[model samples]
Target: MPELLDPRNDFLFKRIFGSEENRDVLLTFLNRTFMEANKPLLSEIILLNPYTDKDSPTDKQSIMDVRARTTEGELINVEMQLFNRYDMEKRTLFYWSKLYTSQLVEAQSYSTLQRCVTINIVNFKLLKNEQYHNVFHLREDRTGIELTDDIEIHFLELPKLDAGSISLQQGGLANWLLFLQGATPDQWEVLTMNEPKLKKAMTTLEFLSQDREARMRYEARQKFLHDQASLMEAAKNAEIYGFKSGVEEGVKQGIEQGIEQGIEQGIQQGREEEKKQTALRLLRLGLAVSAIAEATGLSEEDVHSLSQSLE
Candidate 1:
């Protein structure tokens, strides 16, 4: 028996939880996520884009998310993201906007827009907080008052789950996330007992894992994910390196030119402090406003402002 497939692989996820055949799995998972968050549990859900054989990873164009609609007309999108897309927040907003706006075709009232909820089950960490689950909504920044319930987004950061702490305290959400995180055999038994449909979900993974062609596609998908993560990390490192180099070069050039012009205090007293010290000294030296601006890398307006006081 081959090892069970990981549910976090979006393709495998769609296989187990995105099809009408496994609508129970998707319902339980969504219910657990909402229940744990103290949000309303969905009595029933309809998959707007149910899965089919063409969803296999062999087809590069397969949709990666499980889109559904609650019985109450609320739009829900559940996506399994195995990499930290740095733009997750903005990406979520874009989708939420699309779903919310797509509700009204033409001449429809603004009140016709149904609530759009985007639930992202992400493998890597994105939020700074320790909680594995974070829900966001438009609210007053300081007063903490929600302006509307029209747009809701959930970010389930898998990395933030503390393995030691989640015995059963949070219940179904923890179990489902653990299943996605790859539960051990013993843990799998406990989880299945906790959620009846989970056993079927596990069975789906087992069946997929043993099939030769399915195994091949899963492997290919895993390789693609690994390559994608590597590319994102490399790009992030390059961006950071470029930023530091630019800052160092700019500061070094300004300091070198200041020192060469015989300004005694080229020692940076921090950026703003350094600017003030250099500007004051150049001002005291009776240099022209333009000359001081050139020496300190400040605009003429800035030099004039610095020349006024605090010398």
Candidate 2:
């Protein structure tokens, strides 16, 4: 058996579900997801951003989201996210808002806008609850009254899914989620035996996994995703560190400025006494000797002497 590529990879995911050739596969997956959630099923869909082969180097970095419109004119955005940057909640809302607002043209009435749904298949757990699948909508908090049916968001956390509990014989959303979570060949064979849509998807995955050119593209896409995740993590850490450092520095400067003002108002002996007291207080606050020196206008040696005298 050829090594199978991870369907969670955005590149392979778009090719599997967003391709025009496998429209039925996309339809089946969407219907299963909706039906499992007790929501209205999509009968027909028109792919908006259909998958196209990336032939050139520039084309290899194309956006890998699948945008479609249902027969009811409802827009659906499906995308697989392999890593959690801790901003999915806000990002989902931002994208959903854009999609909803973009539907209306200049001077077009609000009634012209259609319902927009975003389906996010995430590899990592997002919500605090144990449930793997979560759906959200605009609803009143006190009375459970739905404000509008215009917006919807679904998060399918693959890491939280229990494949062992899912029965392939039922052939519902669980089976599809399992398939995307990289089930083994034997498991795929069993799943495909029961689910025809899954069988078709498995065939496509196999073909793509085996093709040398497709594998190369998949590897390149995987590397790009890894590099992007690393960069995002680094950026987030830097932001947090910068915020904390700025706050500490601001507080220290504020204390130093107030002490300097007092020193300017008093005699030289009083100023030296104030400096010693300030240094002692900073030392008690666990500030470093160098920081106390900088804040108190005293040399490091004087700060050290003050610290010893306090001890």
Candidate 3:
């Protein structure tokens, strides 16, 4: 048996955008996303917390929650959504609103607000539009003026992101997506280029996917996703389980009830702190920023800053 594949592990997803050694790869990927060929890349990254345990926690599954940020003082939230729970839209709105508003404390002024990017990785399609990646932001209708480029939301649909075509090999998103979907070892050689960082990440991910224990966890998650997809399909066919309109109606009520009681219900805040400290410690041990970032939730920028502070 091979090593189990666990997508919820930050140590596993480190290939995506965590690690100083792979910083160049991350910068390259983000640069491509920015639409400017040579623009400066993000200096830091605040990785999304995968676990719900906030304080001192054990390494476990990978289910990157709704948010993380960049070291350049930018907030980046990456969410891995496996099901189309009825309140996904509203839930997203609520989380985003919380993140956006949480920037300032009671005594802090609004000027201290930071830029935020919310990236959602969903199994379901968010819109009926043609694009796989949809970005939303506030903009002036008439002049096309962005009231603030500070807050942005990026949605990536796994089902819609096709990789069989030749055109996609041009940049980082394709490469990263393939990596995320657990590309085959045979496909690894096909990803030819002198890009050492990306190659390293791909190699690392491939190696981990071979672990039997990891593969078991990954298979379990895959099965869960399959089950959810089937449920949605059955409901679409007017099946009994899908006819629960009352459940949908009660979702908002339940969420409201939870919120009314001041229950945030996730360890995002605590996880962020833990990841930050872990990143700093790893950096002190002379580990690569990308690796450290992936292992912890700190961004390359944050790690670099912490690394410098220690000097």
Highest lDDT against the true fold, candidate: 2
**Predicted model with the maximum TM-score:** 2
- Per-model TM-score, in order, reads 0.78, 0.79, 0.58
lDDT of 2 by residue, 1-311 (tens): 57999999988998899999998999999998898789988889999988887532124343788899999899999989998878999988888888899998899899999999899999998999988888999999999999998888999999998877877787888888898988987887777766788988888999999999889988888887888889899999999999999999999999999899878767788889999998898899999999889998999999988778876
Q: Which residue pairs in candidate 2 have backbone atoms (N, alpha carbon, C) closer than 3 angstroms, thus clashing? A: none
- Candidate 1 lDDT tens digits, 234-288: 9999999999999999999998987776544433336768887889988988999
lDDT of each: 0.84, 0.88, 0.61
Q: Candidate 1 — which pairs collide?
A: none
Worst 10 residues of 2 by lDDT: 54-63
After superposing candidate 2, which stretches have Cα over 4 Å from the reference? 54-62, 247-311
Q: Which residue segments of model 3 deviate by more than 4 Å? A: 1-29, 36-40, 46-63, 66-68, 192-195, 216-311
Error of 1 at 19 (Å): 1.1
Winner on lDDT (1 vs 3): 1
State the number of backbone clashes in model 2: 0
TM accuracy, model 2 = 0.79
Better of 1 and 2 by TM-score: 2
lDDT of 3 by residue, 234-308 (tens): 766675545676688689799888886654435666677778777777777889978887777667788888888
Q: What is the lDDT of residue 47 in candidate 3?
A: 44
